[model samples]
Target: MNPDEDIKGMFDCCFTIFYQLKGFGEEILEDKLVHKLIYLLPESWESKKIAIIEAKDLKKLKLDELIGSLLTYELMSKRLIREKGKKIKEQGIDINIIALKSSKKHQEDSSEEGSEDEEMVYLFKNFARFMKSEKERSKH
Candidate 1:
């Protein structure tokens, strides 16, 4: 699927959950959700993620602000990836394989530095899994 589709799906899923929680009178803490959302973002969003993490009064952060930042980063990343794909195509190389290779290389290179994004992604995935399971359970 294209990056735009993937990003829309992510946004929808997160926003749905947030809406449900709020509608149910649940106390949705800004800081915690913001942290999870940042972690849930792709590595290409490192700069935005870092900025959010470093922001003061994180507890007071608004959901709209987080969503806007994510949307901006998603669009920027999609454009960059599209441009890179075009370049790779002009060189007569398979973009998928190149992407896979680059992804592996990135992981390897960042492994030594203990990438916070990696850890955050892991946590975010686990949390998403949990949310999915909980949602399924609630359906029963």
Candidate 2:
């Protein structure tokens, strides 16, 4: 949950602690563990956390799905930051006056490119559904 640390590392550290607890005879239910993971997420992840909470029933949710959504969000955000930085460099817009660099053509071009990455979308929706279906079939 440290803003300075990456989400992937933070989650991994939590899992390590969780395993240590298990080794020490402290049993944690999967649902509780998943809930705790979401609860401990930083403010920056509020939107994603809310989406997961509202979109799915926690009892049926797998830990991997939760992490996948979060990691996908993380990657998408990083990609956006990189793309925005590249755009700024291409435009030669002084960071000091970023507000003044608003141009209609620039806005239109950005809009046309779409706000969300298609690959990330596929990972969250299509891929997740496919995985869930496969898991259910395997259970039978």
Candidate 3:
């Protein structure tokens, strides 16, 4: 999976590839599909991946359910990040500086081989924008 692409985009791309493979008499089982999708997720999604894997029988897990769960996780993460930023701003601290510093610190700390999913990077980008706009609103 490409970490730069959104989860939905990644799923769509995989489906397209699967369609092509079907023409060549290569058929992948729905059960195995779930495994591939979960395990293929970026390292940042490890917890969710593990949860999905352990909480249900792979043979019984539908593709729609997997995608729904992933999308839910993404949306929840975004909301939590936004809410945290808002609360920090209300505390009269400069969250923008903290966000930038922590993000950079994270990158510096991660090994070259370790990477986060697109969802996290997306959340951080949105959080930075939210903080910037909030600062501008306060200026007015």
Among these predicted structures, which one has the highest lDDT?
2
User: What's the residue-level lDDT of 64 in candidate 2?
Assistant: 94
Clashes by residue pair, model 3: none
TM-score of each: 0.48, 0.70, 0.64
**Candidate 1 local lDDT, 11-106, one digit each (tens):** 788879998999999877778887677688776567877888787456787778878777777788779989988998899987568879777878
* Number of the top TM-score candidate: 2
Local distance difference test values of all predictions, in order: 0.77, 0.88, 0.86
Q: Is candidate 1 or candidate 2 better by lDDT?
A: 2
Cα miss at 25, model 1 (Å)? 2.9
Taking every candidate in turn, the Cα RMSD to the unseen true structure, in Å, is 15.8, 10.6, 18.1
For model 3, how does the per-residue alpha-carbon lDDT over 3-79 read when each residue is reduced to its tens digit?
A: 66778988998889888998999999999888788887999888988898889888899999999999999889889
lDDT by residue (tens digit), candidate 2, 1-140: 78888888999899999999999999999999989998999998889989999998988889999888888999999999999999989999888776655565567677554545665676789888999999999999
Indicate whether candidate 1 or candidate 3 has the larger TM-score: 3
Q: For candidate 1, give the lDDT.
A: 0.77
At residue 90, give the lDDT of candidate 3: 92
- Estimate candidate 3's RMSD in Å: 18.1
